[model samples]
Target: MERSINVLALMKDGERFIFLYDEQSTPQLLQTLGRYAADPEMSFSWYDAAVLSQKVRRLKESQERTTPDVRRSA
Candidate 1:
């Protein structure tokens, strides 16, 4: 299957942050959010990261639930 880039964007308080990642890169994206939250200079906070992380996980879970499995049952 061809991997496609997924976009998750946030626009708050006149600031916009766009994240581009593939399905396989969700783990990395989660970690990146944490890093952003830890940076004292950045506007991103732990709350933002937590909320976005939930979004990411829910989106992935929904997709997995909808997609059909190719394997046949024994």
Candidate 2:
């Protein structure tokens, strides 16, 4: 059975972009990530996918708890 995974970071030049993906479609995700690391024009780094996913989940939960519900009448 297929499972969901997240792509938590993308690096280019001196910048890192943080992203959360509930699922990824590529069959060779790690290989693709490695290619990015090897590319001379780019720089790349990552957190362990499992660890980063967990962190993202916790942050989302915290944000949800702190954020006011807009639908509730004031």
Candidate 3:
């Protein structure tokens, strides 16, 4: 079993924003995006967070649809 690391990046107005996370860390990543959006000094905006969050959710959903569930009954 290998691990998958998801990398998301955005470059705008000469600035680059990058995030690395696994499926489990997505919520934390979303929170971090919110924090960035709230900071007045950064160029990151709520729209950016919303867009990225949608992307993250879609990726997760696609993965879920492809993977199979295995269970044992005793």
Candidate 4:
């Protein structure tokens, strides 16, 4: 199935950026957008939703790698 996502807003100042997506979009699309928002390189550069989503995913993965894993063994 082909789904369409609308980009409500894409604002950036200096190194910071904010992306707003339409509420009608699917959760999968939203998840993808979140991924791109975390990228250091692509975070600031995205032409479309698809590309942005890719960047967001990469950014999220990078963040996960740096995050400390907490587990307790009993």
**TM-score, every prediction:** 0.90, 0.39, 0.91, 0.38
Give the TM-score comparing model 4 with the true structure, all chains together.
Answer: 0.38
Candidate of highest TM-score: 3
lDDT (C-alpha) at residue 10 in model 2: 44
Residues 1-74, model 1: lDDT tens digits: 66778889888889998999989899999999999999999899999999999999999998889867758432
Give the clashing pairs for model 1: none
> What does candidate 4's lDDT look like per residue over 1-74, in tens digits?
23333443455564444454433444666665656745766754435556666655565577558656655322
Regions more than 4 Å wrong, model 3: 72-74
**Candidate 3 structure, TM-score to reference:** 0.91
Off by over 4 Å in 4: 1-17, 20-47, 72-74
User: What are the lDDT scores of the predictions, listed in order?
Assistant: 0.91, 0.54, 0.90, 0.53
Candidate 1 vs. true structure, TM-score: 0.90
Question: Candidate 3 clashing pairs?
Answer: none
Per-residue lDDT of model 2, residues 10-48, tens digit only: 445668756544434333444455565566665453434
